[model samples]
Target: MNVYFHTFGCKANQYDTEVVRQAFADRGAVVVDDPARADLAVVNSCTVTHTSEAKLRTFVRRLARGGQGLETVVMGCAAALDDGTIVALPSVRAVVGGADPGAVLRAAGLPAEASLPFPLSATRSGGQGVRSRGWLKIQDGCDEHCTFCATTIARGANRSRPVAEIVAEARLLAAHHAELVLTGVHIGTYGRDRTSHDTRRTTLGELLEALVRAVPAVRFRLSSIEATEVDDPIARLLIEAPRHLAAHLHAPLQSGSDRVLHRMGRHWYTAATYRKRIEWLAERLPILGLGADLITGFPAETEADHRATVELVRALPFTYLHVFPFSVRPDAPAARLRDQLPPAPIRDRAAELRELGEAKATAYRAARRGARADGVVSGRQGGKVEVLTEDYLSVYLPTAGWDLRPRFEVTVD
Candidate 1:
């Protein structure tokens, strides 16, 4: 059987797809690159935004139109919370909820006995084949209940993988890939679910310490984490071990207004607290790749609230930003809230925030010109191999005479 996999939203979803892909491959199914060549399609869906779900439906419908007798099995967050909508789509043979490889295998017509280990290792670096980097999922689910988010409702509470198991996967991935990205729904809350006697690896920082010690050859990058959870050990690694841990952090700042944040049920930190933590980190790392996710025009958000968010974004040395206009999900708490902002203001606020983000990114890129940095050969584009820098910059270099090492030192131009 030939299988093609499509993933929507987030690196965690990407990692989940990899797991399911490997499970099929282990059962002797050929993984195809295109949906047209496959007999079966596995789509890992996301419910982060209404748009994401819409895209998934559109993509699946397109696959059905290909007329190759392709049967799709929909899984992940969207599948978990779906109310007969996804399965109702044409060519969808089955729908398996949540990020479980075993459940996906069973849904794909395999018997219960055919399910492999939950977090199985890939034969190559990535899902498709050998690649420059791979995603290593350390945990799953979210414990926080942000009002604007349906992730908690879809994925459930935090459940962490064992330290030894994660280390084993990292070792295997490191053998084929130059870098490993630690991905999860809420990576900042890693190890919080463990009530075991050994507390040595109970934190993300400690987990990094273990990963670094186990696989020193491969560089590890965090997918996304909370600003407040940047503990001392993680900070120490970023400051001291640049080769082990990349100097980049994508901590989400959903809204900078305290009122807006409180309304969103983001009780972890206030705007002031977030600023202090990020500013401290920025000061320590001279060339940090700082990014954040900001939501514009949330329910009951005022003009003053938008201004506060803009001010906070300007005050920080952000390299890039993810500006999302609030989309109402029927299952989310924000959908039920009063005084939801209209479409016009939401679009306008997102545009302004995105413009600011572009300026910051352009400035950061220009500043790094002619500087030497550590990078990995990601892919080829227009005859030049794209070297993704440790600080999240892409520097294209000549493909000729490349050493083909796991990591490379390149001069940004």
Candidate 2:
């Protein structure tokens, strides 16, 4: 059987898709790129926002109506949140939750056993397949009770993979010559769900240390982390880690005003503290790439609050920003709050912030000129080949003798 997987939202979902792919392959199923060419289509859905949920619905409906003889499987957050809706869809044969990917594979008639552990000493040629980068989901779910988030209801409470199991997965990915990206729903909350007192529950910092030590040659990248999680120790690691480790950090700063943050039920660092952390990174790491997530037009968000957010982002050293016009979900607290701004103002604010983000990104790219950056040549466009840097910057390089797949260090000109 040929299987097509369509992954949506978050690095964690991408990682889960890969795991599902591996599971299918292990059960003698071939992975195909096009949905029309495959016997089954797995839609790994997302429900982070109302917009995301709508996308999931649209994709499922389109695939169902296409009549390619492909069986549709709806899994991940969207299915977890609205299993009834997904199951009632025209061609969806299964609805699997994000919690257990093995269940999805099982539903697809694949092997559902626990994965075997591979050792760290394995070589790149010994793994299952080849890829440039890999996302290892070391943690999943969240415990944060933020008012605007729907992830908690979809994914449940925080839980972490055992350190040994994560290390094994990293080793396998490294053996495949892939850069390992550590991902999760809430990575900072790792180890909070462990039951044994002496199990040596570790922080994200400690887990990172283990990965680096175990797979020294493989590049390691982190998914989005909270502002409060960026302590001095993690900051030091970000600055001093081997060059293989990408110098990119994505922290979510949902809002800038303390009042809005409090109303959202976020107890992490304040705006001042977030600024200090960014400053710490700027001083230590050269060519550091900073990304942030901002939600505008939340319930009760005044013009003053929006201005504070804009001002704070401008003052910070962020290379890019992901601006989301806040959407009210069914079960979240902010959904019922009063004084929601009109859609026009919400869109206007988002547009302004997006423009600011592009300017900041251009400045960041310009700053990288004359410096050497390590990246992989992804593909060719026109006559020039595109290079994707470790920190996720794309630069076009003149194609010559360089292999498009191999990682290389190119001097930015």
Candidate 3:
């Protein structure tokens, strides 16, 4: 049998897809890139927002029409949260929870292995396939009690993969010549669940230290860390670590107002403290890229609060932003808030922040002009070769005798 995997949403989902794909391959199923050519189509879905849900529906509908003879399997956070909506779709043959991807494979007539001996191991070699970037799952799930989030419910309690296991996977990724990106639902909470009574629990900083020591040749990037987790030790390692360490950090500042944060049940340092951490990192790291997540038009977010958020975002040194309008999930505390902003105001605020984000990104790219940086040449585009720097900056260089996959130090002039 031939299978095609469609992945949507976070890096963790993508990582899960890889695990499932490898499982199918182990069972003698050929992986195909085209849906029409496959016997089965599995969509690892994401429901971070309504827009993502729509996309999943559209893809399933299209696949159903295009892949008339194939079985369609739907699984992931989106499917887990709203299984009835998806399973009712004419195309979907099976709906499985995000927590049990292995079950989806089994239901689709694939092998029913209890679990892979090492889930993080990838079957693809030589970096010759569609995946150039690698996502390493160091942690899974969340323990934070944020009122507006559905992730905690979708992923359950915090679970940390052992440090030795992560190190082994990092070594494998390094050997494959792929840059490894550390990812999790709540990555900052690494080691909290696995701590022993005899020893102080290992922290994200220590885990990172172990990875760097185990696989010094691999470029390592973090998916995202909470603002509260961006402490001194981690900050210093990010600043002074070897060149293989990614020069980018994504810290989410859900809201700028203390009242809004408190209402959301998110515990973190004050906006002032968050600002200082960003400043400290920017000053220490070379060619640093700072990204942030922001939510606009939350319940009880006064006009003054919105204004303060805009000011704080503008004053900060963030190179990019992921702006989202607050969406109330079915069972979340924020869903019942009485003072929710109207749809028009929410849309307007999100649009404003998006515009601001674009301008900041352009300014950051402009600053890179005339500076030299190291990047891996990924592919050819329009007679020029494209490369991505460690900090995730994209650069285009004229394709003149440059090796396609060579790591080169290029001047961004």
Candidate 4:
């Protein structure tokens, strides 16, 4: 079988797709790059917003009508929460509804022997080898019930992987890739579920410590974590072990307005508390790659609230921002909330926030023009190889001598 795999949504989803791809390859299936030549297409879904589902529907339909009669297997978040909508799509052969490679293989008509859970081995793309940083999923699902999010609805409550298993996987991934990104729905809340069952509770900090010792040659990066969850040990590792851990953090701040945050069921920390933690990290690192996700025009959000968010962004030393306009998902509680903002204001607010984010990113990049940092060779772009710096900036360098090492010392230009 010639299979073409495409993924949507977060890094967790990407990791899932890669695992599925490897499983297909193990069963002697040819994974192709183009949909036209493939007999089957595996599309991983995301249920974050209405736009995401719409795109999936459109893509699935197009694949069906693309003259090759390509059949797609829809999996992931949308497949889980979809109310007969995804399976009803034309040319959708099967829907697995989760990131289970065994189910996906069965749906693809593979042999029953392919039902075992594939281990976290080194991933190779088209038999080329591991590319750039490897994504190591430490856990799945979320414990937090944010009103605006449907991730928990799709993925269920937080379920962490065993600590020993994660260390074994990290050691395996480190053999090929120099950096490993710890990914999950909520990675910061890594081991809270195991506290009751075991006397010695392991947190994300302890896991990181284990990974650092187990794979000292490979640097690890956190995919996305909450601001308040950056514990003392994690912070210390970022400050002290620069070579082992990247000095970058992507903490999601859904809304800067405390009232909006409360309405969104994000009661873990107030805006003031979030700011305090981020400011401390910023002050400690000379060039920290600080990023946050902001939602614009939430239900009942006022002009004053938007201004407060803008002010908060201005106060922080952010290298980048992922500004998302609030989109109503029917599965989420915020959909039924009173006083939802209109499309016009939501778009306007998102644009304003994005502009500010770009300015900050440009400034951060400019500041690092002459600074030398550790970087991994990402890929080729426009005849030059793009190197991703430790602080999460891209520096394009000549292709010569690129195959010498897994990482390079890059001077940002």
- Among all candidates shown, the one with the greatest lDDT: 1
TM-score of 1: 0.96
Write candidate 4's Cα lDDT for 135-248 as tens digits: 899999998899999999899999998888888888778767888899999999999888765577799999999999999998898999898999998999999998888999
Q: Write the per-residue lDDT of candidate 3 for residues 1-413, one digit (tens) a residue.
A: 98888999988888888777777777788888889998899899887776788899999988988985887999888887874888987667888878465697677976676865675356464223433467788888898878887777777889888888888877776755557888889898888888564177888888888888887867788889876686666776677874757788889997778788888887666778777777777777767777888889889988778787888899987788999998877646788888988888888988998899899999988889878886765566677877777666888888776665657677765
Give candidate 1 misplaced runs (Cα > 4 Å): 112-115, 126-130, 197-201
TM of each candidate vs. truth: 0.96, 0.91, 0.94, 0.97
User: 1-413, model 1: which lDDT tens digit per residue?
Assistant: 89999999999998888888887887888998888899999999999998999999999999999957899999999999999999999999999988678888888887545446644755374344327888899988899999999999988999999988999888888778888899999999999889875655489999999999999998999999899999989999999999999999999999999999999999999999999999999999988999999999999999999999999999999999999999999989999999998899999999999999999999999999989999887776676778888999988777775667657789988
In model 3, the runs with Cα more than 4 Å from the true position are: 123-132, 196-198, 377-385, 398-400
- The residue pairs in collision within model 2 are 124-175
Clashes of each: 0, 1, 0, 0
Rank ordering of all candidates by lDDT, starting from the highest: 1, 4, 3, 2
On the 0 to 100 scale, the lDDT of residue 29 in model 4 is: 96
Error of 4 at 150 (Å): 0.5
lDDT of each: 0.89, 0.78, 0.79, 0.88
